[model samples]
Target: MKRDQARRAYWSQNLRYLAGLLLVWFAVSFGAGILLVEELDQLRVFGFKLGFWFAQQGAIYAFVVLILVYVVLMNRLDRRYSRDEEDPA
Candidate 1:
C-alpha cells in the first residue's frame, strides 16, 4: 500500500512536469509564432525576426531542450525511488 502510494505520487509529479513542458512548447510554437507574429516581428534576434525565429527554430530548440529535461528528471526520479526502496523507514 505504501509502495503504491509512492508510485502514484511519482507519476503525478511526472505528469505535472510533462504538462508544463508541453505548455511551453505550445506557447512558443503556436502563440508566439502565429498569434503574435506581427507584434513579435518588430523585435529582432540575431538578425532574424523573433516571431519567424520561433516558428522556424526556437520551438524546435525548445522541444529538444524539453526532451532532455524530461529525461534528466525521470532519471532523478528513478534514482530517488530506488534509493527509497533501498533505505526504508
Candidate 2:
C-alpha cells in the first residue's frame, strides 16, 4: 500500500519534471526561434543575428543543456525514490 503510493508519487513527480522541461524546450525552440525572432534579430552573436543564431544553433544548444538538466534532475529523483518507502514520505 505505502509502496504503491510512493511509486505513484515518484511517477507523478517524474511526469511533472518532464512536462516542465519540455515546456522550456518548446519556449526555446518555438518561442525564441519563431515567435520572437524579429525582436531577437535586433541583437547579434558571432556576426550572426541573434534570431538566426537561435533558429539555426541556439535552439540546439538549449536542447542539449535542457537534456543535461533533465538528466541531473532525474538522477536525483531516482536516488530519492530508490530508498525505502519511509524515506519517500
Candidate 3:
C-alpha cells in the first residue's frame, strides 16, 4: 500500500481502539458509578457498597487497567505500522 494510505489506516485503527476503550471506561465510571448506583448499592464488595466503591476506587482502578491496555494495544499497532515512519510522507 502507498505511504499515505498506510498512514491513514494506521491512524484510523488507533482511533478506533481509543474510542472503544474510552467507551468502556465511561460505562464503568459513569454508568456504574452514577446511573446504576442505586441498583449496585444493594450489593457489597468487601463490606463497602458496590456503587460507592465503584464511584471512588473502582473508577481509579479501571482507569489504570485501561491505560495498561491502551499501552499494549498501541505497542502492537506501532509494531505493525511502524514501517510507515520509514516512508516519506
At residue 42, candidate 1 shows an lDDT of 97
Which numbered prediction scores highest in lDDT against the true structure?
A: 3
The weakest ten consecutive residues by lDDT in model 2 span 80-89
- Ranked by lDDT, the better of candidates 2 and 3 is 3
User: For residues 1-89, what per-residue lDDT tens digits would candidate 1 score against the true structure?
Assistant: 66877788788988998899889988988998899999999999899999999989988888899899989999999898777666656
Better of 1 and 3 by lDDT: 3
Model 2 lDDT, full chain set: 0.91
Clash pairs (backbone) in predicted model 1: none
Q: Which stretches of candidate 2 lie over 4 Å from their true place?
A: 86-89
Candidate 3 lDDT over 1-89, as tens digits, reads 58778789999999999899999999999999999999999999899899999998998999999999999999999987877767665
What overall lDDT, based on C-alpha atoms, would model 3 receive against the true structure?
Answer: 0.91
Ranking by TM-score: 1, 3, 2
- CA displacement after TM-score superposition, residue 55 of candidate 3 (Å): 0.6
Clash pairs detected, candidate 3 = none
